[model samples]
Target chain A: MTGSRRQRVAKAVFLHAAALVVVFLMAFPLYGLLLTSLQPESVIRSRELSIIPQTLYFEHFRAVLAEGHIVPLRRALVNSTTVSALTAVLCLLVGLPAAYALSRLRVPGRNVILGALVSVYFLPTTIFLIPMFVLLVRWGIDDTVFSLVLAYTGFILPFVIWILKTFIDRLPLQIEEAARIDGCSHWQVMIRIVLPMARPGVLAAFVFAFILSWVEFLTPLIFTSSLRMTTVALGMFRSTIDIQVGQQAAAAVLTLLPVALLMLVCQRLITQVLMSGADK
Target chain B: MQAVPDSPAIGGQDEWTRAPGTLRRRETAFSLSLVAPALILVAGIYLYPAVYTLILSFARFDMAALEIGRWVGLGNYKALFANAAFVDAIWRTIYFGLLIAVGATVSGFLIALLLNEEFYGRTLLRVVVVLPWAVPPVVAGVLWGQMFHADVGFVNALLFRIGLIENYRIWFGDGRTALHIIALAEVWKAIPFMVLFMLAGLQSLPPQLHEAAAVDGATAWQRFRHIVFPLMLPIIIPLMLIQFVWAMKAFDTIFVLTRGGPAGQTTTLNYFVYVEGFQSFDMGRASAAAYSLLVVTLGVVLMVTVLRRYAALRKATA
Candidate 1:
């Protein structure tokens, strides 16, 4: 008995120490980024590295907001928001019906479709960028936000449908059957009965789709050119290359802050969605 | 048994056949309507582009041609095979992929195991572990790039301050160290994802088994090796396979940090395709390279999926 107790205590101590080290390693880079961002320009550029900032400078944030370098920061924010929102809506608009059919219809080729969709998850966006760019040019939508949105929808729709289909599969079928028995049309059953029942799944899909679009770099990098369509992720790149470390840090923080906050707010939902056997 | 219900003279026969047929038609219409938008988007965006790329691989297409190209069957593939740069790029890509995938999976599994225990501030620690994943790839790449900068980077500065090095090292500028540095960046960015997946797997393990092993006087190492390791294989194998594929296709961090710099030491197959297609405007060769990547990725996926299924079957039988 004594030996067992000792073993348990040893395990606990070991785990705690390991966890502490891991936590520090995980947070260290962000801490470094923050420290560098807040330090004075001279201090940041100094040869000696300091773990802590000598002096905090809030002015960097102000300066970044004021300088309006490359593309204006506000424009990037709006562009990201608009593109992400549209992408989310488009994913739902396209994913919902397909998910429904996959879940409920017992349709032929459903398994094949599911497999095809899952394969899309593995496709590297970089390989598609050139062809997609050419296609966008051919369609006369290159360098436009529309093309980005379309690309995002195409990229995310498969995974969204897969996830939503799993969620819908778990839902009880009696509700839809009852609605059908009441002389309701298939559309009515979907909108009134099934959708309301699958609200969490829908919301989960929307959040994932939106976050992905918001944080996406390659598509926007290759597809869009002008300030009007520049996303925050691309905007950060454009601004950072000019040696605006402070402003770039601030922009990075801003771009990352909302998604972090959203994840925290929806932590449970996000965790559930992630942990579910749906493809990443 | 219900033959009496066939009262066709009373208008029942027409109603029976017509109603069933109409229902079938309605079901078909509903299914198609529900699927049309998704199909159209997938076909137009993904399928069309993928097919077009395959077709372009066979042609002598260039930017000057502006979408009008002559057929040059096998020319591009031949050139890609003959080109030393492309060969070197493919070799580097595979090396980088293996390094990152194995490194991330092992490190992540260790971290997950440590985090799985009851500990102080476990929740906060979990959140911290997720931080690397939350940061966008571009941000992560840039952050690492800035950190490794020769003069201003904190890494060299810290090393020099600690008297570990006499001179500042140019980490990203050297061909030998550049790919390794990029690999490290890839591993750092990907480790969190591996941890998240592995953590979920770890959490699902039964505590009773561990207790039983302990009661049987199994040493900690033995318990892990004999019990936990075997059970976790089902999850770990799949995770490793998926991560391997992801590593093979990794591009963003490399692009942001290295751009296959220092004489293309870090250029992966994906980057090679990007440059050939976008930079050089050599669509034909790029397409061939892209198809090569697709074939390799598909082969890996097929092999892993089979391995996973076999493992699953063995588990069931056992």
Candidate 2:
């Protein structure tokens, strides 16, 4: 029995060691980013770079945060926040009802529409880039945050609808019927019952939409000009070109902050959504 | 089961239990109304632009007027196909996409398998895996770019210390190595997503199957080969299809890292379209190239779907 117990312990140790190595591989880049961002430029450029950081330097962060240091990242943060928030709200407003209809009521050409949405979801945004750019330019909204919001919604709405549909599909129809028996109309039942039950899914979809828009690079790169109009992503890219390694690292860290926080807060919920999405 | 006039309408149970024809009509109307806004958004944004681009692919685009100048049927396509550089980019994109797909899948499977085992700190490991997933592709590119920087990079520092190389090598400056480095960045970002799906697949499997196999004295590898892999196919196949499409769509990493540099070795179809449309302003040829990419993506999806169906049929008969 002791021999078997020792063997079990050894196996456990082996499993943990393997798991830690994998974790290190995954987390190493993030660690490097954080370390580079925190250390002084001298330390970063030093010949003997250590795995562990020994200093806490805020100069890079300070420089990045100040105005005119690669387009004022604070303003870019606000812009990204505003665009992503609007995109999420729009996704919910436009996606929820559609998801509801598809999951509950039989829409015409349901299969065909669903298939098309799947294809659009998989499509590279380059396919839409040229014409969308032309249309936006004609509409005189190409460089605005609102245009970014619209473009983001165009791509992200498919995913939002698909995810919301998955959530709504899992809901018991009995409660919806119960609401109907209570003399509520279809919209009333949806607004009152289904919406409340699917809050977790709704929240998940909203967070994901926000993250997707927040991290988007190509749309903002193509659609906007000028540093003031740029996003955190574009600003960071522009900074990289400027070869301000310290500032770039700091900006990258800042860019990661909101997304990291969202992931931390919604990890479980996001996992649930992802798993459900995979099942589909 | 009979609908009767005597049933009370107050409960609204009669409304549900009543004949379906009228209710279905109302339901269909309501459904359509609810779906209309989403349909309009998609139609305006995706469908309209897609159709316009399709037409633009066959016509000369007037940049000044921002409209079609003249119809040049197949001219742009012929030009693209005739360009050896463009043709090489097409093949390069396929190669890079296959590398990303295969790398992400194998690594994702191994990591998912590791995470599936019961161990301490597993939750922490799972959570940290999502870091790469949340990191923007551009930022990931910068991060990895720094790691692989020709000088002052940790990779060089470590490699030098370990005697793996005598000097710090330029990773991105070389055409041969640039594409692979970008793929590595993409694979890093893609693995968490794949792991999320693969872990879900693994978790959904019945434990009894494994326990029974163990009781039959099957080794872990044998049990996995016989039981786990087959059951995981439904999730794996579709996941891989999406991954391939995503890898093809990947451009930010390439954009940030190489900008299709080192004599355009890293230029994939996605970047080619961007450069053609935006930089070169040859909207006609760019549109044609974009359509070519779309066709290839659709072809891949179709091929995978057919293959899956064939495999399922074979399994059923077997």
**Top-DockQ structure, candidate number:** 2
How do all models score by TM-score?
Answer: 0.91, 0.93
- Per-model fnat list: 0.43, 0.73
Q: What is the lDDT of residue B284 in candidate 2?
A: 94
Q: What is the CAPRI rating of model 2's predicted complex?
A: medium
lDDT of 1 by residue, B220-267 (tens): 799989998888887777677777788877777888788878788888
TM-score of chain A of 2: 0.94
Q: Against the true structure, whose TM-score is highest?
A: 2
State the lDDT at B145 in candidate 1: 77
The global Cα lDDT (0 to 1) of model 1 is: 0.78
State the DockQ of every prediction.
Answer: 0.44, 0.57
For model 2, report DockQ: 0.57
Q: For residues B47-126, write the lDDT of model 2, one tens digit per residue.
A: 99888889999999999998889999999999999999899998898888888888999899999998999988988898
Q: For each of the candidates, give the backbone clash count.
A: 0, 0
